[model samples]
Target: MNPLLCGLAANPALPPELVDRLLTLALEEARADPASQFADDLLHGLADRADLRHDQILELAAHSDTMARYLAYGGTLDAADVDPGSMPNAAVALLDERRGNLAWARFLATHPDPQIRWKLASCPGLPQDAVDLLAADPDEEVVKELALWTDSPVTARLALHPDPEVRIAAAANPSTPLEAVIVLAADPELTLKWTLSERTDLPQALYARLAADPHAGVRATYASNPGIGQELIRVLAADPELQVRRAVAKHPRIPLDLLAELVVGDRAGWNLLPRIAAATPAELKEPAGSRHAAVRMLVAQRRDLPPHLREALAVDPDASVVRAVAPHPGLSEELLRAMVARHGVQVLAAVAANPDASGPLLEYLTQHRPGVRRVLKEVAEHPHATGPALLACLADRTSRPLAAAHPALPPEAITELLADEDHQVAEAAAGNPSLPRAVMLELMP
Candidate 1:
């Protein structure tokens, strides 16, 4: 099919009469040359569109094309009255629909090919009779596939399968009986224990056992579980493994007091303070007073920091803290402008990217730092950027793609951009609403 016709067929807003005309043309082409793949493809593509009127879908469904009829029936063998036994492709499509047709599912369950049964095994809506038959299939892969489903009638039996891989898949299914879960939890296979450790819905005793697992990896995964209790968090916080402790530090439920204790050292403070969700005024003071520049820099990155802390960090002796807080929206305009005047490129780029930077500040930053990509792209895309700054950005290769889409670009600049060497630049220019209506129609495919 021509790209234009394909685009039109996919457009839901295409008037019904136009769709009818396209379908009529395609069918006429198919009749004259039965081997015409484009006509067949167009017919097949339109068969599954839910937006098509019933009459249009009927035309596709009644066509001689088997694939079109198959697609129209929504992948149901019985719905199309195509022989269920005749086509392996039909069976694959039918299984995908997961229509939960018991007879067809049962028929496919024992089909000579194990691959069909393997596909059937993963269907979430498989009937119990089909599940029962497939679960006992001699083909290990089919049984292994069936073991993945929580609703599989035979999950209990599959849990004890001789293959640990099969048992591991069964362990992931919540419906696997508790006795089997306990067995898998203690099983020598570390992967099975690791998988089971991540599931919080398991009984607390099982979680506790997994938390104390000899392997630190299993304990870390358990520590990160959202549903683990405060008591477990406390235990994990003291664990000798730094990863286990780090996981506790990041847990959403980690107590503020525990977090305070964890940040006693400079290394811990640098890693943990920025992640604390809540902090008291006293907690803020400790980090603010820390001797290490890195510790203070971490505190400066906190979004919930108080205005006083922000103001103090904006002028911090260390350049890192100052740069960290430059983009903070809470900084006063006067303070921001002072930083702009005093600081170099890093601070200038940060200020330009700040959402609260005023239009005048952005325009000045854009004109001064047009070569700095951070400033150019940020200012070009900023809603507050003026026509002159956008036009400057359009002149630079680094920012042209973003600048082309800016509504401030004059009609002539946008038109020039519409044919720029970069396809993305041209595409962005084509979408600019500032493009004259006459120019827009001329660029249409």
Candidate 2:
């Protein structure tokens, strides 16, 4: 057998007729010279393939070689006469296929190795006796694995198990009995409520109970459930806990009025505007001009604001609103220049990072704000940054790392940065992707 034939046999693009010819030649060569390593290698390569025809696999299984039979079986024992002991791989393969006689399942269920028994426990549709044996296995993990199976006949028993982890897995299984759902719903374990709240199939009584669960985590989790009706949303929206209200505000079905109401009076709290799906311009106009800077900050974060609104928010008296609107794509060139002039250091970095900021605006920042290292760093990293601005950033130590990663950096500059004392600078230069092929070759170990 040609040693090169081993690789040719495994090529997926090889025609079926050629593959068959190669297999026949390998078999003939193997039988003629049993100790030929090249023959054995070809046979092993053919036998290990998943795409082989059923007839080809059977041919390999009938051969005298043991590993060839193991690979041909491909983790399935559909063959009528498999001697597992003679083919050691069959022992693990049997459970992977989940196909075997009741006797085999019984034997594996009681195997001394907990890992073996654990694997058997997760197999779907196991015989009742085997399931019973695994349910009583000494290893908690084996029992937990059994609990995770939705079709497990012993779900009711596993749900009431002493260990909370086992019960949690059982509760997560959708096939768990309704009676078990009631028990786990009221289970003192706080974590169980958190898990049960995410389940949409639970009875309404359980949903109601979870909505008002004493623990804020449970209420918050329940509030986020999509199946919860508008009434529950209303209930959670009024809950004393801020986190629960926040979760309710995020529901896609939440009433626009309710979402608009939640956005108010949260001065230092979360920005609910972006997360609220139904927040329209009409709904937000009032909050956009509210006395509270926090509410205005949320409005500024919205990307849908009209040009006038974006311009108004860009120059908001509050620094928070200015910061939020600086990166917004809607701001005009004149507005961007005005923002940079009005709020020099405060908004410079944010303006530099804006994707919509023009190349000339970036150059202006590079020329006028040369002393602001953070602004220079943001400009160096900005995709819209001009070539001259990038070169200027390359000269500044603070901006050099980001400048090295910029595609506009000259090849000579990138190559020199590769050997800089700072490894970060060298790494950034190497990752530029457009580095000359010669430079990349030098980087190879």
For each candidate, what is the lDDT?
A: 0.70, 0.73
Q: Among all windows of ten consecutive residues in candidate 2, which has the lowest summed lDDT?
A: 84-93
Off by over 4 Å in 2: 1-164, 173-180, 187-191, 200-208, 211-275, 280-282, 289-291, 305-317, 367-374, 391-399, 443-445
TM-score for each model: 0.58, 0.58
Cα lDDT of model 2 by residue, 13-49, tens digit: 4457666887898889889998988788778777766
Error of 1 at 442 (Å): 1.2
Top model number, TM-score: 1
RMSD of each: 7.9, 11.8
How do the residues 1-445 of candidate 1 rate in per-residue lDDT, one tens digit apiece? 1433443444344456666777887788788888987687657655545567656655664565366337524742243443457554455455556543346788888889887788778777777888888878889888878887637648889888888778887887766787877777778863665767545577777777779988887788888776688888899899999878877767766775576566556264343343454566677787676776765776777766788888888887776667777778877778878776677665777777767887778778876642476788888888777778788777668788788877777879887876577766776676565766566445333
User: Candidate 2: lDDT of 266?
Assistant: 60
TM-score of 2: 0.58
